[model samples]
Target: MISVVLPARNAAATLPAALDSLAGQTLDDFEVVIVDDGSDDGGATRAVAAAFSGRDSRFRLLSRPHRGIVAALEAGIAAARGWAIARMDADDLCHPDRLLRQARHLDANPAVGLVSCQVAFGGDARAAQGYQTHIDWCNSLTSYQAIRLGIFRESPLPHPSVLFRRELIDRHGGYRAGDFPEDYELWLRWLEAGVVMDKLPQTLLTWNDPPGRLSRVDSRYHTEAFFRIKAGYLARFLARINPCHPRVIVAGAGRITRRRAERLLDHGIVIEAWLDIDPDKVGKRVAGRPVLPWDAVPGPEACFVLPYVACRGATEEILDRLQSRGFVLGQNCLPAA
Candidate 1:
């Protein structure tokens, strides 16, 4: 039987729907383990208990003192008994066939240790237009594409829609607290452990984007924090994959670019040049190196760092320009973490 773990912390407003969705899943061989994380209102817990009361023997609820999401998830992981462990957010809706499809996929593909499906951004009883682009981007991600693109970069497969083989999670020692970018950290750890993950080509969850969400409320969700984590992980990965240092070009003069360059420099990686598009920053010096204009950038064999997440569009444009100039990724230009 599949074990679905839902960790809740005062998610009263949206918890019931999630349970209801699970109740309707086509795969009836699954059990729900809801870990109530010290809910002050107690309403979310009661609602959850009431929703599953007397229905199925697979539904179980456990209460734990408020520790945080990571801790709560760790608790759920410890309590899970199924060979396959699936995660569902307290405020998200799962498609009726979500478990069946993912379980079938995992059963069919033993080489894949983890499986995640595309999700639609819909909530407030309706869909959001802004998520169309994100949804499409998520759906287009292939396993290899995810690997080369830096699993943590470009939105590594969504966490809520993922299913993990319990054995793999156990081998990795489960989740850890203070993992700033928790989801990314876990995915990267799996990758580092030589675990393969893939995305199912169907929308299986509906993500709810609400006002005052945890990300919007917490500094832990800040862009800089995520960027730092991703960069650190990438740097570590690169060091392992390519021990020999290559000439690296710091691709932006912004704060992020400079920060990343400094981190790489700390690792004794040589910085060949700083490339920037802004005329003002083009000739300026950062970290004792002159900033060169984008056009006057160094050879493609030199690694490039487009450190600023905000400059993603511009980064893509620059990559296009580099490709047009016959500098392809993994060959001519590699990402400098």
Candidate 2:
């Protein structure tokens, strides 16, 4: 049997559609674990969850006090009985075949620890450009190697579109409560622990971009928070992958780049040199590390390289240059954008 862990807050307005889609799933041998996360909306959230549980024996409601998403998710996860546990947001809708396809893929492929299907951006594409672009980028990482290469770029997997094995949680642990995006942090942690996550090319869920999405309201999803958590994980990754452990050439020397890359220093990652195209910055020192011209960057043999830039398309351009000089991404050259 399969288990779907649905976590909800005061999501009364959008809860029904999410439930209806679950009830209409093509896969019948599945249970929906609806977690009412202390919704204070006049009991509307509980009423809606109770109504669904009343009609469908497959739907189980775990009424709990108002904790945070991490606590609610843990409650539902503990209650889940299936070998494979899937995730669903209270505001997102799943395709009828979402569970069936993901479970089958997992059944056929024993090597993959987690599997996420492509997701449709269920919002105005034109109005929500940044979110839409992020969704598109997440979809582009369809292979295990691509997921590893793009993991630091952003969350390569959409939270609501994934179905992972309970074994992964048993071994690596589950959603962590911290000052960061829980899903992204989990992915980074698991990936660091050698979990092999892959993606199905087919789109099987609607990743809605509602105005009141948690990422929009929560400080945990802020840019600085993400970078903070990323620095620790990225530092580990560099140490493990690079022959020159703890030593790297930073590929950007701008103020924002230096500020963000400085986080790695706390992890004992030494900056061998800073590569910059600017004449003024080339001879200057950032964090007491010399900034050199980009064309004079050391080869992958000399030291590992981290392309630390967040400009819209600067990372790709930097990677192209690095690859041209025998530096490989997810290998000697890792990106930190």
> lDDT, candidate 1, residue 29?
92
- Model 2, 73-155: lDDT tens per residue? 99999999999999999999999999999999999999988999999999999999988888988888889999987888778
Report lDDT (Cα) of residue 53, candidate 1: 52
Predictions in order: lDDT: 0.73, 0.90
Query: Per-prediction RMSD in angstroms?
Result: 2.8, 1.2
Candidate 1 weakest lDDT stretch, 10 residues: 303-312
Candidate 1: TM-score?
0.89
164-240: candidate 1 lDDT, tens digit per residue: 89998658867766636577677777787788888887889997777655665777666666655665656666565
